[model samples]
Target: MSGPAMFSRYEFMIAWRYLRARRSEGGVSVMTWISLIGIALGVMALIATLAVRAGFRAEFVDTVLGANAHSTVYMVPQRIENDLTDEVYVVAGRIQDYDGMAQKVADLPGVTRAAAVVRGQVMASAHDKSNVAEVYGIGKADLEAMPRIVDPATLRGDVAQFGPGIAIGAGIARELSVSVGDKIRLIAPEGARTAFGTTPRVNSYEIGFIFNSGRYDVDRTRIYMPLDEAQSYFNREGVADEIEVFVDDPEQVADWTLPLLRTVGEGAQVWTWRDASSSFLAALDMEDDVMFVILSVLVLIASMNITSGLVMLVKNKGRDIGILRTMGLTEGAVLRVFFLCGAFTGVLGTIIGVILGVMLALNVESIMAGLNALTDGGAWQPEVRGIYRLPAELRAWDIFRAVGLSLTLSFIVTIFPARRAARMNPVEALRYE
Candidate 1:
């Protein structure tokens, strides 16, 4: 005859009976409740933490790629040696045909758009307050094409009359105590170099638009001026300092470096967004991994409670186990019965924790808003965290990993107590009776 099947109905019945046993009768005790709650809490914490980490990383990368170029092509001075005199000289100080290069790069297969820009540092003053700003001279069309600047949520002013005025960041406007249609003076120190010395050129321009890119540094320190005006202020004239190139997929920008270098020709280098922000991204990734490992320890400790509960369960059920063993139940069957008890607790706890974690992650924005309101809007600091708000993204992989970790620890810790209960001799178990 075939032996009883593994984890059969009777085994489940026994496990369930044991789990529901009264505290005085060697049934499920306070330890069981504690273990269940601990696992649930540990799982919830892991999922929530991972979701927030993922969201933070995504938001940071989006802000960076949305507000700036995927790659930039700029001229770098090339060292050349004179053949006759053997004297070293520098050549190709600036892009000779930036517009042509931009047009050519824009035609490349993966490139979305290429715009030549003149960038410089200047002091902006209005209402007697002044701040240092990095100004980008770009065409109205190109400025509008930028994802972050054109976004309705962050844009505060109009870009229609861009050429007649300039677009300043919200932080800059606030610091200078100016607003749209107000005049802000831009002072360029290197304006008009002469025989005597360089003179600072101060010019007042109307603020046509304002944008908040959500990055504290960018919003506080960046300004956008019309290409022609920027060229004049920075003394670049017809040449551009760099050509900002946008692409369909920013992640693949490194793949296009060769093509961009070919298009821009010699003395020009391609600098990708990754090159500028790799360290920050790497740090975020490392932190995510470290946090997961650290939180897993909490889950392991919680699972240990299962061991304590199961060991007590085995001790309290010795008499019942003796009767069952004398009645022809196998040791393997007894082991499965107790194992199922612990496994059920882990599985149910994980399910509850997943539900709670997902709900928290989905509602994180609302919760942040509520907290900000209660705290008088002082809960978040964009300058310190780099983003104005907290973000939480629920990823399937993270959830699965948490579940696996919980279940694995639960199963491993259940083994020892299960084996002890299974190997007990019926004679010894009933000696007291």
Candidate 2:
């Protein structure tokens, strides 16, 4: 322990000596441990939060796309030559050969399925309750082709063999107080234009199934019926308003969207899931960014603890620092020693935090489920809103960003204290001889 060569030749040795020494021997202070734990906690929180946000967004998008087509080729009337009349007219440009158009889109790469869809705004009334909903008149094959948002296993009755039946989302069912086998009346806005006035189309159909789509608006506003039945009721038999397309991966649906739109030719408007849900996706992205920034501030606060710990260490070990300087230890070496001490804390904490965070994020669903079970589901039931279970999608980039921010801020905050230690006067430090 009295070997001067190890202490003088290696700055790291001296740094370790200063940091690892017992309290009686003036080393390893309590503040250092607290600062380390703080950094770990901060990084852990950031990683888990980011993972949860990413997971929830992915799940929500999947759920939404399940209930909606990835892309839709709809008809929009070509502008009349110069519009000579002051006409506030609504045009229903039906897409002829809708099935053929859907097949064209399906033929394109990345496209999985396509279907002709007839959409209408309607009022659904049942059990003395009424709610405005979007009624989808989907072909039997198209309806079969559509992915299920509500697990098919959960349906009370047969959905595949639907016979003039209307499927309702959980929210709609709740609002109308209706369920499977119940009848709901739909009032369509489009009808015969008589000399006296426009007639509203009305029809009633038995509920085939109740779908829990896990989407706030879709659950509340989506209703489904057979294409033939819907067309007959709406007076548009053998014609679909739009052709909807589905892709293998909805996230990268752009690869299929443009070409499909082109396939349908000029004046044909194509709508992708991204186009329809842009606002919702954009808002989610903004919230995620804001959360990242907010959590970074917490890391910065934890980094300050690194500064505090280093400062306290420098103060307590002033004499040792001066004695080391009196030996062959240069100011730069002294600077490095303190720097390593703080840097070590940051690195170690970051490692542990990342590991802990990743583990927690990966198992968030099971962990939440376990907690709910322990508390008899009461703990989480009330909080369940669109998504009933917690989801966590661990992304390496998110973890790297969190750790990078923590370590960078931690290292930067250590500089001042390290500089102070390096500048300590040996004369004053060892004065009371």
Candidate 3:
């Protein structure tokens, strides 16, 4: 701002002239192009990978929270004694006053909703096909509250007459080759206790609705029944196996654990979503860190191309550098000129890469759909990936990291060649000429 500033007009003009010079005139034009393109590709790849990884993780967590309870309150097992025969046995404890308990839990602060649930494992059969299913007994109000299941956009059948029938997942329906109005038989191993022993409870119910939760495993094994019907089928009369509790912030379930425990009483225990899926989330985080390191190495390798190109340019322009030095150009000015040559290439390439990466991330889903159409549905498999399509989310932090890494590496690699040109001996450089 005061005197002649750094990177003055003359220095820029000299750098620009060198970058535009022909190969026959002592310029590494091809190497410059190669270095610029390499940097651009590397930066683009880094940004795209990070965006996809973030999107995938976010989507996976959302599906988990959407299709399942954030936390569940369960009655702990207790020991009981039979006075008639003087026999002592351990009986599975169940929430006796589930309606009142559910209401209490729901009324607690931070609790969004709480519903009594009767869950059991049963074998389902239809059209000579059988598969294991996990049945959930939920009230009509609770079912309606679950937007992921009863949402009009994804539900295939009517839930208006839900109590008398059952709601099955799309995967289960497909596996058993059954549709709406078809009767599906459910066989429970622990049914009514009789004189000899317990017998499997077998019952058939009409399929009332089909819902797609967009998760493969959930769709494959889940079955929903009305609360009263589930209670009768599971031999759980006037009681519930557990209370499924939802909260406004699932990630902060730990903060609400004490309150939930106090409300559920001493006989009950609270299990959180993190307890169920922590390992999977940890693995995803590890994968993201590894990917970042791998791509950073790619960017470094691309920046090395800048070093090689600049070194060649320094060697080719030794005589010109000598003349400039003899004509009163300072050593610092010579260094700045060569540095700008490499910096310009790196800066321009990084800008182009940023634009391309952001565009790709924002429209990744549409692009994936196009590719799937061209490849005959081979681009992505919902069953294998657990989601319907590829996802991408661009964040400001990821973009900054990519750009910073590219520019930093460019400047560092350019320094050595610039210093070499600055310290060249004018007499030796021009003696042969």
Candidate 4:
């Protein structure tokens, strides 16, 4: 027989004998039951941790991509005269031809879509209330190309209802105690003092709609207006702060961004959404690493239980080991038998834990709903935080990692006991009995 077939036969026979012996026992002992439970708990912890981490990361990516553009183009500080004119359109048209630039970025190998966005900081006031917020100006047609940050049905008024009006974030509107159709005054800084004193410009607008992006920064402090209207208000006739681009494959960001930067020339800077939120991403990575290390301690503790249980098994099967030795069984074969028994315990526990973890991940939303129902709707709802329920993302790698770790720990626990069983003498074991 081939090597694989021969090994398979040997493993099957040894595992069968080990399992048969376990079944004929006077039921399972308290210690064995304890070991089984320990393994089960350990496996469950690993599965739950992996699922939660994957889910949170996936949801965070979705939330960010929904609220912000995938990439950005901006002029370096003090480079271009902030004046907007027909020449501005000429430069924009030329830049669009560069590789990886323009609304056609989605046509690139991995890009999904691209858009141009202009943003500025301004103070908005309505009636007696005033607050500083970021004003985002966008082309009405291009806005449709990006992810919908706000649901039209959720708004008190329609975004497209007013021509020169603006949309306010839900949180900001609530804080200001203003609603749709309310008049809002906009104050923006324009022009630099050239031998003159402070230069300031102010404009006014009416609130058109209220939108919620599920992110506190965006929802609480962001406002959107028509591109042309914003330019007129800011005294920036034809110039925009930046052009935003969206991609289909976020993983290929670096590959696409570099070529686009080269195409845009030395005057323009290109940035990815990852660069925009680097600190947040770093924090999430650190949190996952810390959580895994902490949870692995549970698995280590379970492994200790396995070690103790195997030590007891060695004592109980002393005579059996001696009889097998007298019947010409090799010491290695004897060791394999006990190892199979311990491995079986780990495999069974891992399988059960995986099933339970997957079920929990799939029904997390329903589970949260049940909890809310039980609590009589007293739970805090955070529309600004993106998702309401815990997210669970299961990957094949997570399962492989869990099973591989458990089996290795099980084998390690069986080592000493298996060695002791192989070394037992038939004469001494029979004499003791």
Worst 10 residues of 2 by lDDT: 1-10
Worst 10 residues of 3 by lDDT: 21-30
Q: Taking the tens digit of each residue's C-alpha lDDT, what string does model 4 give over 123-232? A: 87776888889988887766545454556555568757546678888878988889888878878776334468647667777888787665666777888888778766
Residues 1-433, model 1: lDDT tens digits: 9998899999999999888968575445677878889999999999999998899888888889878999999989779999999999986466668788889999999899999999999999988899999999999899989888777777877779688889988899889989889999989988888889889988999988899887888899999999989988988888898999999999888999999888778777889999999898889989988999999999999999999999989999999999999999999998998899899888887888888888888888899899989998788778788778789988999999999999999999998899999999999999999
Candidate 3: regions farther than 4 A off: 1-3, 25-27, 80-88, 366-379
Off by over 4 Å in 2: 1-17, 20-28, 78-89, 192-198, 255-257, 359-390, 423-425
Which 10 successive residues of model 1 have the least lDDT summed?
A: 21-30
The per-model lDDT (C-alpha) reads 0.89, 0.81, 0.90, 0.70
lDDT tens string, model 2, 1-433?
A: 5433432447676677666758574434677777789889889999999999999898878777877888878888644443677555666688878778878878887778888888888999987899999988886666766566446764556776466577888888889888888999899888766898879977788988888766667778898888877777777877888988887888887777568767998768877889877997899899999999999998898888888888878887888888988986778778888998899889988988898899889899888888988999865562254656668999889988998899899889999999999999988888874
lDDT by residue for model 3 (346-398), tens: 99889988988888888889989999999988898888888776789899999
* TM-score of each prediction: 0.95, 0.84, 0.93, 0.80
Query: What's every prediction's RMSD, in angstroms?
Result: 2.3, 4.3, 2.4, 6.0
Scored against the true structure, residue 215 in model 3 reaches a CA lDDT of: 82
Model 2 residue-pair collision total: 0
Which ranking of candidates, highest TM-score first?
Answer: 1, 3, 2, 4
TM-score of structure candidate 2:
0.84
Q: What is the lDDT of residue 423 in candidate 1?
A: 98
TM-score of 4: 0.80
Q: Pick the candidate with the highest TM-score.
A: 1
